[model samples]
Target: MGAAITRAQIVEVADRLFYEQGFEATSFADIAAAVRLSRGNFYYHFRTKDDLLGAVIALRLANTEAMLDGWEGATPDPVERIRSFVRILIMNRARIMLYGCPVGTLCDELSKLRHVAKDDAAKLFMLFRRWLSLQFAALGREADADALALHALMRSQGIATLATAFQDEGFIQREVEDLLAWVEAQRPHQDRPTSETRPQP
Candidate 1:
């Protein structure tokens, strides 16, 4: 194979290792072995672990942006589009159960390590945050758009963490139901006359 393909394969393997075993826990040898590349050859593609990490983060950001863009093109309705965002948990329930939310897990691991790339890794979440905020704003509550986006993001993270901890498929189902209900109730014509408690994730 050409060097470009080899390099891409190394990054792909490294991304999976970083997600499955964590960036701190995964070593260069592990990635090199998984990619079936010699240490010297790996060095030819990436001089340091940070180089691999930068590629992995870039891959993640590209993939996330593509997914969000696909969702936008899939439907024109903002509510259903936002609902599509909320429903990702149900769609990826099995992976979330096994590994927790990928973005959340990466952020937590990087934060704990005090890794300089932590902020860079966090751009994945920002893509989702901005996409959801735009959807909510299009739904006519621009004032609360960011807050709503964060709320949904937090709820998904909590459910993924608990689902991984408890291995509870039923809990995932229940939480998804409540999340859809919450989304369904956020109609543009709805009126709020009094202080209402926010729903728990």
Candidate 2:
């Protein structure tokens, strides 16, 4: 006989399966099979497919927030902090390639679900964008912070897509480095004092 599976284990397996195959493609039976349990046992833990999905979303959001924790204080330079955020994403390229960014993929899949889940996914992205905007504003760039935040968010998603399409980790690393350099160059220059225009009678 196989070892007994707990509710947490079932949810963990479901999360991976959902990430790999999407919510519609992964079923209770599939999750049960992975956990070596029956559909009835899976139901005992989750009650419904939506319930399982909610659990997955909650878990993913918590995990992502935890990863981003303390990131603000990681460096004194705002530009360095922004670069660190990108580096974190690049370092997790393999995982992102495997499961996709939870916020991005979940938001894409949200339309199929009811209101609460959709709202939660949307809120998660908003929070992410807000954080990026603050980081860009701190860099003292003259461009609109919202625009910069959107660009950064889009670049991340675009790089993840490129990784998925090309199956190349190097592509993301190269592009992230280039993007960081461009952002750094956008910082505003301090104005210099005029030489002979002031204090003349």
Please tell me which predicted candidate would have the highest lDDT against the true structure. 1
TM-score of each: 0.92, 0.78
Query: Which ten-residue region of model 2 has the weakest summed lDDT?
Result: 192-201
lDDT, residue 195, candidate 2: 35
Residues 147-166, candidate 2, lDDT per residue (tens digit)?
A: 88888888888888777777
What shift in Å separates residue 190 of candidate 1 from its native position after superposition? 6.9
Error of 2 at 17 (Å): 1.5
Go through the candidates in order and give the C-alpha RMSD of each one to the true structure: 3.9, 7.0
lDDT: worst 10-residue window of model 1: 192-201
Give candidate 2 misplaced runs (Cα > 4 Å).
1-5, 97-99, 112-116, 141-143, 190-201
lDDT of model 1 at residue 165? 98
Candidate 2, residue 7: Cα displacement in angstroms equals 3.1
Candidate 1 residues 67-96, lDDT tens each?
888999998788789888888889999988
- Would you list the clashing residue pairs of candidate 2? none
Clashing pairs in 1: none
**lDDT for each of the candidates?**
0.87, 0.74
